[model samples]
Each structure stands twice: as structure tokens, then as C-alpha cells.
Target chain A: MKTSEDKLNEALRSALKRKFDDFGDQPNPSSYDLIRARLKQPRNYKYLLLTIALIAFFVAGVMIDQHWITTKSDVLSTKTGIKSVMQKAANLDINQAATTKNQLEENDSVKQSVSEPRTIVSSTSTKISMSSVVPALSPATLPTEQTNIVDAPEILEQAEIAALPVQISSISALQPESFKTTGLNLPAITITEALKSEPAIHTNSQKISWLLNLASLKTYQILTVPKSGDRNFQNFKFPSTFALESLGYKVSIGAEKNGFQMMLHYSTFRQRYSYEIAGDEYVVQAVGQADYKIVRPGTIMNEDNKFELLGIGLSKEVQWGGSPPRRSPQRRSPVRRSPLRQYYASAGVQYSHTLNAGPDIGWINAGFGRQFAINRTVLLNVGPYAEFSPLRLSGKGDPFFYQPYRVGISLGMKLVRP
Target chain B: MKFFTSNKYKDLTQLVRACQKHDPAAQTVFYDRYKSKLTGVCLRYAKTRAEADDIFQEAFIRIFNHINDLKEPEAADSWVKVTVIRTAINYYHRTTKEQELHSSLDYTELQLDSGDYEKMMDQLNVEELLSMINELPDKYRTVINLHLIDGYTHVEIGEMLTMSVATARSQFMRGRNMLLKKLEKKGIVHHENF
Candidate 1:
């Protein structure tokens, strides 16, 4: 049973053990120090990169702020150049004081009273009057026999128009300024026609006014809803939209043609809606028609919201003589009792691309607008506008009154295209 | 498996704790205790003594770094052995080589009984046998040394070297036959010696 090969292998194993019996090793003592010094714990390198990026962003923001302030000073310097140009133009009117006897006699209704029969040298007055047109035509210049009492400002406005190149057909638009404490002077619609004709007057005021009106304009708007149950609301009973619970902002840009304008606006706000749960307020954010997030007390859960409105509108000065024609007071219904002081009411059809509960972006904004003239070149428009998205016409007592609305305030500055 | 490993590693608690705390004195004791055994393991997979040294250093560094994460002090011996073995295998993979892992041996499917191998060992020179192992090809040397000298199972050898158990068994048997042939040619033949 003991093969010769087996016996040899047995002997070989014994010899191998005997050979390595004294085998040993001694590593250098310095190696331990080397391993210990370079010990590394596992770490996520991504987080380190992210932190570095955030610090870089913070530094860049500081640099941008410093540059922005420097640029703002440059804007001020440009504003100074404009003021100087206005002064130079005022000093150089081509035709001065053309008040002939026939010119005075023909316009018998709007006669200017000269204090004495002596020949008055108007050259001295003309130089002073040309500098500040508004200041020159005081109420004392109006004829005493003109029956309609008018504000001194309106008289000055008439005088300013008199200084323009075109001849106004009637001056009756200046009469209602005194008798009626507050209403738009209807005949001032003449100004829109005057602006449309492109008169050949290269006066500085006309040039500035034309440049302001020539192009599509952009405006910033602060969208707001009335505060809930405040004194302003009790008196006016405007639509209450304060329950939405956040600030809103809007931006609009568009072209104006013949006192009719169409603008595209994008607005952002916090859309909040609430319900009653167990006799307590359960505020919820409406992310979509079917999607909502429940809110607990002390939870700040206001998410940003955006909507687009394409509004086509027509504006006109208010009529003063008779009762305003009841051509269906359509625009006023939406903005009826808003407490804001408004002028020049306008009607417009607006297509809203709000986070729609029903159709995707519909003709939901049927509303009103109030355009206030800030200067000859700029205007501010603020009014309550209601979206028909939530309206149910079948409801009682004019469902229109129940519709909540947001206020859009747009600042329009004149632009000239090349 | 981690819990079982932790439970068994309890035996090495004092040594492991010292390594975890980075105690240089205890670390010296720990490293010295296993260095020779692990170096022997490293040498079997390495082509030369320099390669063996590199493998040994890398394995120990890994052992110390993760020593704190090992919960069972008693299993440290098995864990360190596996680490050194893995390090050697990894080193072989990382290096470029033309060496064949398994050499073809003669057809001999016979296995010797315990007494038969004992008699064979008694007749052979042990130094000559180890030197002949170094001369063996890469995979044959690895399989034979891991199986016979280290007393590892075929399954354990396959796991360490990333081979199937059957491949490990085949390489081992072939390595054994080749070693016997080499010894026979060196005039340490079975019947001739007897």
C-alpha cells in the first residue's frame, strides 16, 4: 500500500517544515509612522465642490453690486444732458408773439384781457413767456366776459396749445375744469387727434412728446388686491382678493395706435385658497385644480405663481356735458367700486394663461383700465381687473360682483423706434 | 456575516483597539506578529521579493485604516489573511504580465494517503522543494502553495484568486504532478531514494 512516490512526498513535507522553521521578518520601524500620517477617512468629494462653487458665487455677487452702483452714476450724467438740451431749445423759438388784432378779434369767446389801451410791447413778455409756457399764461390773461369759469391750470394748458403749430378748432374743452371738481375734460380728446396728424412743428416740447409716444413701451406693475375688510373697502365695497395672501408683480410691453393699445403682461403672485376643516381654518395652496398642499399654523408655504394676459383696449377722456351714454357700462362692472382714484376708464378683452383650472389659457380677463398722465411723455395705468376663469354666470345678484380681481399698475414711458 | 465576523474578532480586541487608536507601540506589536506569515502569503502571488514587499505594505495599510470599522476582534486574523491575499491578487491584475497561470502537467489523477506523503517528504530536501516552487509558473505556483502550504480549501483558493473551484482543483493537481516530476528529475526519485 505504501507507493515509493508517496513515501518521497511524505519525506519532502517534513524537510519543507524543517527548512522554514526559523523563517521570520522584521519591518522597518518608520513604516508605521508613514501609514499613520497618511490615514484617510472616506468622504464625498461632490459636497466639497458644491461649497467651493457657492463661495465663488458670493464673491461674484459683491463685484456685480459695485459695478452696478458705478453704472447708475453714468445714468445721472445723461439726465443732466437732457435738462441742458431742454434749456437750449426753450431759448430758441423761431416765431415769437404773433398776437395780431384780427387774431384776437376772431376768437371772441377766448379773448385775452390787456390791462391798458396803450400799445403794449409784447417783445419783453414774449422772451419771458417762451422760457416756461405753463408759468406765462396766468388766469389774469383770460377775457372777463368768458362766462365759463375755468381753472388757472386749464387756462395755462390752453395757452400752451396756442403756442403749438396747429390751430385748435374749438377751445370749449377748457371750460369744465372749474365747475366740476373732478371729471375728465371730454374735449381733450382733441389732443389724441393732434398727436396722430404729425404736425410740422419742430418745437422742443413737441419733439420730446413725439419721441415719448412713437414706440412700443414697457412698464413695471405692482399687482395688488384690496386688504380684507379695511376702511377703504367698507366705503367702496371693492372686490376682495387679499385672501390670496402674497405680493404680486407684473410687467407689460406693447404698442399704442390711435389711443387704442394692446399689451402683453406677465404677472407673478402667491395663489392661496382656503377651506373649513373641523370649524378651523385649513389654508391650502392650489398648485393645480386637483393638486393642493395642506397648511398648518405658522407654516410659511407661499409658492410663486405666474400668469400671462394679452389685453386689447381702447381709452378715451370722460364726457362732461351730458350723462355718460349707457353704451353698456361693460368695463366699469369689473372695477366698479375699487377704492383707487382712477381716470380715463378703458375696456379690454384679455386672454389669460394663468394656471388654469379648466381650459388651457382662455379669454378670461374682461376688464377695465385707468390711464393717468404723469407727464406729456409718460403715463401710469392702475385698475382692478377680473378674470372670468372662476365666474359662473348662472348665480344670483350679478355673479360679476362676486368675482375677485387683482390690480395691475403699469408705468408707460414713451419710446422712439429707429 | 458582519455580526458573525465581529463576534469572532473579539479575540483580537486588545490588538485591534491599539491599531484603531493608532498606538505606535501596539501597532509595532501587531505588525510584527503577522508580518512574516503575511509576507509568505504575499510572496506566493508575487513574481519577486520586491513585489512581495509592496503587496505586504499595501495590505497592512488597508488593515490599519479599516481596523476601527471591524467589530469583531477575534476574526482579525482571518480578516487580515484575506486582506493580504486580496492585495496580492489585485497586484497581479494591476501589473502587466506574460506569465501563464496554469501549466499542463502529465496525466496522473492519483492522490497520496497521509502516510505516503509523510514518507515522500522525509526523502526530499525541503530547501530544494521551495526553490522549485519559485521556478514553477505563476498560476501553478499560486494554486499549489495556497492549497498545500497554506492549507486553504479549493473554494477558498478560487475566491482569493478569482477562479472557479474546478479550475483551482485542476491547477492544484497539475502543480502537484509537476513538482513531483521536478523532484524525480533532480535524482530525488521515489523508488530510487527508497
Candidate 2:
């Protein structure tokens, strides 16, 4: 009943099984040992990836901090100098009160009532209506305001006050014995101390206020030719180019409420475009070994012209991190410290117009960064960011074209105000 | 063929369980047990002893690495053999540089008598038969080995080789005829039957 094909298959299978089933040959005895050795060896790729991650983190930290680019606002010496100027102004005001008393009584606009003793809360802009008259403080011969409201300190400029001669004396003239009877419980604060205290008081009232953040970006442009059937465009190579002109800058003015910042921004950057030809059909020769090469007769091209762009956008911030603790409304703390740190991510769309002769483009942008508090009112930030654009930028009558996208690091400062 | 049918089967199961945990001593025993059988497989698939050794070692490494994936320890024998065969195929596919040349060969005109082929296979020794199989083109040799000696169905061979079942069957026929021609050239079978 068996056919020749079945018989042939049976014969082959029977012979193969008989030969190979119990077949044994001596292999290199070291094969198992080699396997053991290989298994024992640590995986180098995991370590390599870890090392690369650490190096990248270190480099990004260095780039973000930029310790070499320290601002005057960050220096202790500048703060000390400002404190000294304020101290001298306070001493001058206390010392000159007696000398200027006769001149103060002659001005009809100024009224002094010595009978009813009350707290003297005086400033150039504000006058407290009390049972006793409070004299308005002027830059020439007047004591500064003793109290700082939710608004900033209404004090004379330190430069104007520090220009006068100062004497070391008790500030009892500004804080009279009668001030204690008024029961306001206000401390005898000097102009120097008031300047130090005003920021905390002002920030407490500035929950939802306007914030202006300025940013500078070092842009890297990505260029690609549009997919087309044309052979010339397909064979073109776009090598990346970078220079000082590649640095883009942005200014965002927005308001933040409950950690959400909605901003309208204006950004600007310049692009310098260039490309090279590559194909098997055309013989290629480099022109000075640059990005471009000569492929056809009179087809040599090299462009290093500036294309300045002015862009405007609207963005909203998404912040996620620990925030500063809130203060009770009824109980005010005399001093408030800055929060440890904060982080934010933002996304938006932008439309740009070229200041030079070029095509206008639109971009969708996103960025994330860590914020370092410089003070209660100002924060410094640095982060990696990217922008994507779909518009094609091409030369008129040129066969080659490219769509552009940009990636960059944005360094900026946020200034908060009521 | 039936192998490890009784107490040896229990030992193989225990050995596989130990190997799954990557016990070094058990791995050595497992290696020693399967080495000869898998080597026989590699030798048939490879052209030379050195290539066979390479495939055998790579196959064993894969067997040890993936042993933990074998849910039923009883299937270790078949699993190991399948791993060895697949490793050998992958090794040959990676190293074969003349694939285009082999694919361009004409297999349509090989007219041979199956009766003569069947008669010749009985006289041929295992070494001679293996040599004839090795002499065939890579595609044909692999298809013949997978379908005939390995007891794989044409559908299984097609899936393994990434070809249609029709192609696998046609390739086996051509390879069988080529082997018969070699036997005829050696005077072991007469060509007049064709």
C-alpha cells in the first residue's frame, strides 16, 4: 500500500533517526565553562547607560547654573551697600528734624498739633488723618514713613538721602513717647529696616498679579527637504549650521493665579540657511570642503545671509512641585522666606514675521524648567525647550526647499508684582 | 523516535527544573545529556565541523538562557532540539552571502524516477546521505532537513523558513532528485530508470 515517495521518506527518516538519535561527539569541553564565564561577567550596557545619564545630568546642571554669569543682584556686597545707604539716610533724618523745625512751622500747608500725642506715620505720598496732625515727609527735610502697608515702602530714594551728612543718634524724634499711647503696637522701625520688611508685606497681598519673565534661547534649527518626486530636491543634503545669530530671545508678560501663568510672549531669532548636493548621477566636488559642493555647471550655491524674525505667542504655565505655605489672613508674619524651589512646563503657539526678505512662519512651542528663587519678587529659570513649525521656507525659483523646526535652551527671569 | 521513555524521562524533567533555576552543576549535566543529540542536528545543518560547533555552542547558550520559559519540564527534549534547529537556521541565514545566487538556480527541469531514488537510499550510509544533503543549495538543504529528517510538516517548514507550503514541498522534491543524481554519479543507483 506504500508508494515510492512514502517508502523513500520512511527510509531516509529511519536512517537519520538511527544515526542521530544516539549520536554523540566530543565538543570543546570549555563551551560550558565559557557560558559560565559569560554569565558571571556584569552587563556593561547598563553601567554605560548609567554613566551617560550621570554625565548628561552634570553637563545640564553646569549649563543651567552658569556660575560664571553671576548677576549684581546675587552679590552680598551689593545688598550690604544698599543697607548702609539706608542706615545713613535714617541717621540724617533724625539729626536734621530739630534744625528744620522752624522751617517746618513756616509752611502754611503743614500743620503740627502737639497737644494730642499720636503715632507719626508720614510719607511723601500718604498722610494719616489722626486726632493729631501728621506732617508729610519730603526729600529735603523730613523723616520717612514709619509703617509699611501691603503696598511697597513709600520712602525717599537712598541715593537722594545718602547724599546728606549723617550722625549716629536715637530715632526717638520719629518715634515719640506719645506713639506708644496710640496702641497701634507698631515697632520703632528705622528706614533701613522698613526697606527690608516691605517686600514680605507687599508679596502677601500679591496673590494673583502680573509677572514678566524674559528668556534668551540658543536655537538649533532642523531643516528637511519636502518629500517630492523631483530628483534634484531628493538628492540635496542639509547640514546644520550654528553661529551667534542662532541665539533667539523671548519676553513673556503674564499673570499667575494658583500656580498657573497665562502669558503673551514676543520672541526673535535669526536663521542662516545652506545645503549641499549628493547624487550618483552627478560628479560631486567640494567647494573648500564646506557644507555645499558643486554638482552642475553654474549651480554652485552658498548663502550666509541673516533672516531676522519677530514672533508673538500666548502660553500658559503648568507648575508641579512643592509650593510655599500660605499665611493666615488674621495673623501676619513679620518675615517670610522664599520657597525652596519650583518647576514649570509651558506650551503655546506663535506666529512670526520676518524683518528681512523671507517667508513668515508659525511655530508650536513647549518648555519645562526648574525655577530658582532669587528673592521674593524675582525668580531665575533655565530649561531645555523645543519649537516645531510646518511652514516651508524656500527661495523663489530654487529647486530645493526645506521645512524648519528649532530646539534650544531658554534662560530667563520672572519678575512678580501687584 | 521514542527517547527518555521511562525513568530517564523523570531524570530529564528533574534536570530541566534544575536548569531553569540556572544551577551550574545541573546545567553541566543537562549540557552533557543533550550535547551529542543536538550536535548531530547541527552537523546535518552545517557545511563543516567548525560551523557545526559554532551553531552547537550558540544553541546551548540560548537553551540555558531561555530554559526558564519552558512551562512544562517534560517538553525539554523537543524544546532543546527546536532551539538548536532554529539557531542553526539563523546562523546560516546570517552568514549566507550568496542568497541571490542560490535563489536564481533553476529547479524545474530535474526529472527523476522515485523508484530509483527509493532504491538508492537503502544502499547509502548515514555519512554518505548527510554529505549528499549538505551538497544541495542552502534553501533546499534546509527544507529537506526540516521536512524529512526532522519530521516537521510542510506547513511547519513553510512557517519556519518563511515560505509558502507549496514552495517547501517543491524544494524537497528538487533536493531529493539532486541527492538521487549524486547517488547515480557514484554508481550506487542506475540513471537508466529515469
Q: Which candidate wins on TM-score?
A: 2
* Model 2 per-residue lDDT tens digits across residues B1-194: 23333343257778788777667767777876787778788888988766786788788888888888899988888999999999988987898776543332245343445555555665656677677777877777787788777889989988998889988887777776666567667543433544
A186, model 2: CA deviation in Å?
A: 36
Report the poorest 10 consecutive residues by lDDT, candidate 2 chain B.
Answer: B101-110
What TM-score does prediction 2 earn?
0.37
Model-by-model DockQ, in order: 0.13, 0.24
Each model's number of backbone clashes?
Answer: 36, 0
Error of 2 at A177 (Å): 25
For residues A225-334, write the lDDT of model 1, one tens digit per residue.
Answer: 22221111111121134433344555555655433445666554443332111212336678889876543333222222333333332221120111122221211111
Best by lDDT: 2
CA error at residue A252 for candidate 1, angstroms? 50
